[model samples]
Target: MPGLDYFSFAEMWSPLFLVFMLLIATLYAFVVGPWRQRFGGVEAVPVVRQLAFYGAMLLLYLVHGGPLSLLGHLMFTFHMTDMAISYIIVPPLLLYGIPGWLWKWAFGRAFWKPFRLFANPLFGLFAFNLLFSFYHMPDVHDWVMTHYVIHGFFYALLLVVALLNWWHVMCPVPEWSRVTSLRKLGYIFANGLLLTPACVLIIFAPEPLFAVYNDPQVWVQAMGYCVSGDPARLLEQFEGPAFFNLMSGREDQQLGGIVMKLLQEFVNIWALYSVFMQWYRKEKSQEDDPAFDHAASGRLNNV
Candidate 1:
């Protein structure tokens, strides 16, 4: 008999993971509030920024530490959903939530010169897409899911690259920004173009592209990453991912590709809109401001 209890809390509740999430939240609260004065008189973050940080952490827990994580191991579709939320959505929240002063302090060190290279609008666009695409290559994918440590390390790298990719556009630290309005627009559009090939390959592949979903042996081993208990018992109880699958593996892979692209598009579209609105408002503000010179001031006021 097939079962999805491997993804069920009844069988595999992750209390340790829950504790870890709570610990992070507590740390964030202290850092942005009572801990600020201790950090060389860094001011408290705005309430809205505080909410973004907390909310991002909460979503991280829900998606990665709770049922969604188990679901990710269960199916490729859910796995892509996990990636979308974690890599695409969470980093922006973090960028926005952290105070600019804190970012200044962090990147002020000489160690970040390497990050500056990757964080450039032109390079970030190419680097993030290149790394992201490489990670999905079937050979690379098999190697990672087979090794939990490598899997964790690879995604951690992706998260870092993701943060760098978004830096030029949403850089909380003003001094760090390297792109102007036109370049920002070009950078985002280029990113969308660069990433499309990965999704297109996944979506159009004639067969399932990932070993973790298509091969029962690899699938079972991958499940071991999430499913707890004895190997012998686990093997006896479950046959493969089919035990938990609701759709054919091919369909699952295709759907996963589509979902990833759509999620990426949604985030990019919002980013473009935010950039446009900010630019519009800035131009409006400039037009309204009276110039310092008398004649210029009079002309601005008349306009």
Candidate 2:
């Protein structure tokens, strides 16, 4: 890990994204808290919703704007960790954080027809997995990591699709809901299945799959996206990623893939449980209805 410390930026922390996150939280507060009457009918956003939004912003900064971002550039394992948080965790948080009224206002507008189409359960499932799988192709992955703009664009797309996918399940806004209670299980399971092949490809590769992670030259070039403050210093002192505990480059890559798949499984299972419980409760409530009791009694009297 000694050589890997070169990628650490404890000495020179970048606060650009910290500032940006704060600005976003502040703007949201203004729009949702004080200026609500001016902008829309939403005058009082719930405190919990505010907390969710702020939490997501802070997590985003920690992952992308903080030292963890540096680690991601240095190692593929950290990179996949970054992806899990950004796409898997953050999107649902964002969906839950924003008020349903806000979503309704947006969806009620003229352009929501297309939004509804894209955010449909089936479409989100297919589109996100397809884009995600394509992104992992070694050549495509290498090119993306090496170019900062494309890297940002690709990740941004991932986040958008992630949001769309989760919205089908959470559907915080009532109008845009696609999947019914039972169908949610199928939707979530299908997503995990689609995502599994990509992880398996990385996990079972006989050799390292990503050159940006395995090849020192390719790694350094991609590293430039994070370690922007000092190129010459890095040139003189750069060493490849550390594979601790007798792990080789391929082993490290496989570990990353394993971690990605594990996180996905955990999230999907939690979602399935949540959806199933909600469905179960609704069915139980219907059975407990006074109308249902009266109907059963009438049938018994006939007997």
TM-score of each: 0.89, 0.88
Evaluated with TM-score, which candidate comes out highest? 1
lDDT score, candidate 1, position 219: 77
Error of 2 at 221 (Å): 1.0
lDDT of 1 by residue, 82-167 (tens): 88898888989999998887777667888988765666676767767898899888889878988999988988888888888888
Count backbone overlaps in model 1. Answer: 0
Per-candidate count of clashing residue pairs (backbone under 3 Å): 0, 0
Candidate 1 worst ten-residue window by lDDT: 1-10
Q: Candidate 2: what lDDT?
A: 0.79
Least accurate stretch of 10 residues (summed lDDT) in model 2? 237-246
Error of 1 at 50 (Å): 1.3
